[model samples]
Target: MNHFPPLRLLVTFEALSRHGSMRDAAARLNVTQPAVSQAIKALEDYIGVRLIDRSVRPSRMTEEGELLARAVREGLGRISATLEDIRAMQTDADRQITVACTLGVATYWLMPRLSGFYDRHPEITVNVQAPASDLPVLSPGVDIALRYGTGGWREGINGKLFDEIVCPVGSPDLVARLMEDGVDLDTAPLIHVRNPHNQHWAGWEDYLAVKGITRPRSSGQSFNNYVQAMQAVIDGRGLMLGWRSITERAVLEGTLTEWPNGTHDLGTAYYVSTGVDPSKDALLFTQWLREEAT
Candidate 1:
């Protein structure tokens, strides 16, 4: 290994930090779990200190690991952002389609279905940017914007993707505990996400009112990012509001479970917006998205 260990190790560590567990990192990186383990071990040996604390299930990082992970995340993010800008500078005739969306939608909804689209249309190059919230605007460089809202963007043709449903969800353990203890929703250690960018989203108060629950949210913590908030829910820290498109896959995977009979559909749906005159690739991508939605 050279002066900084292989770039692969750093990349793997970033994925691990983002995804939380080895199996998840492997799924995100499209590699085997053993391979992820080996990459971390190699990087730890090169750095001459332990990066991962394997004592706990799902293996969290140590302080040293957090330092390196933070640096690597920021560094890689800058590099990726620069590359996107460079890609945007390319000519339109090059036929690369750039789609703008939020990180949660990219991670949960689009990513899982992307491989299928790529497999069918290998010639099309898709560049996805998740720099903002659910209602991503169509900038000069963006061809398509997948936004979450009631749908009436003045600039483009807006088509609905899926209706939004919000509800309380927590780890499978928490679900079992609540069921066993016969606990009510108002008293749980609710996980709150305070995303200032997404004011359209409903909170516990709104959700509780719709359900006719008079009790206030007694105990909880707040996170600025949805990712960290969801992580807390998965770790059994508390119940957080879950969206159908965003949280259904994790629920299906058995990591999180919906609170027993606790769900309400918000009147918003995700929509794909594009200019009046769309490109070939952009049209194809939107069509594929619609097909996926159906």
Candidate 2:
């Protein structure tokens, strides 16, 4: 519907105009002088304009060529500017990130502290995903993963967020009742978290084994994830192994109570993982996370 010279012809003409010589334009465009001359000839034929004054010694642009050069320079400059604006918009879109973590960690730890991140970086939006498998993986579309482990993940750039401290926790009322009844820590009804995808998680058996106490498997009830287990513990159903990072707020708020002398260092910590070529927004978020953990 519209008639226009080939973009290559226009580009060659522009280069020739800017450099004032076909040889210089060829060097700038990495083309032979003949190719540059041919492109200009093609453009001239297409536009029916004598753009170059061959009568000059070094070959100069004619009056009409000077006008076309101005239009071409302005058009190309605007195109470059619009391209940069599109790139900026793409960078802004990248500010929205997806973080993977356990349900309990998302519910208790990350969600509560996210307000601080939003306050610091209003432009960044964090989308938290709790994997069905308690372990978080840096899968495709996942920007960052808040993983709990001893920190040897082969996935991405891994950094320990903070040390993990485990302890027995129950509802305040249940804890009070158990203490009043003089129930031993090991003998308390334990709430267990178990799943096929669960790796590196300390269960009731592992915790009891660490304390040199053995209990029957029937001594506790099991849940697929920490969220359900924590709710049951809060409802005074039983005591669950609580990670300090996840349950510290609940204990502080008096919704949950920790047993005295129950804390243990399991030699594990929460780590943040991001792809090697992380986006600027992802780097900002990880930095914020490290600051928060500190």
TM-score of each: 0.67, 0.67
Whole-model lDDT per candidate: 0.86, 0.90
Q: Any idea how many clashes model 2 has? A: 0
Candidate 2: residue 7 lDDT (0-100) = 88
Number of clashing pairs per prediction, in order: 0, 0
TM-score of 1: 0.67
Model 2: per-residue lDDT, tens digit, 1-294? 168888899899889989988889999999999999899999999989899999969778899999999999999989989999899878877678999998888999999999999999998889999988777898998999999889888878999999999999999999999999999866898898888888568887788889888779778889888888888999999999999988999999999999888999999999999999999999999999999899
Q: Which residues of candidate 2, in runs, are more than 4 Å off?
A: 1-92
Residue 12 miss distance in model 2 (angstroms): 46
Cα lDDT tens digits, model 1, 1-294, are 358778999999999988988899999999999999999999999989999998987578999999998999999999999988887767444567888988888888998999988997887888989875556888898999999889988998888988888878999988899889988876777888777777877888788888877765544799876788888898899988898888999999998999888878879889999988889889988999999988
Which pairs clash (backbone N, Cα, C closer than 3 Å) in model 1? none
Top-lDDT candidate index = 2
Q: Residue 33 of candidate 1: its Cα lDDT? A: 96
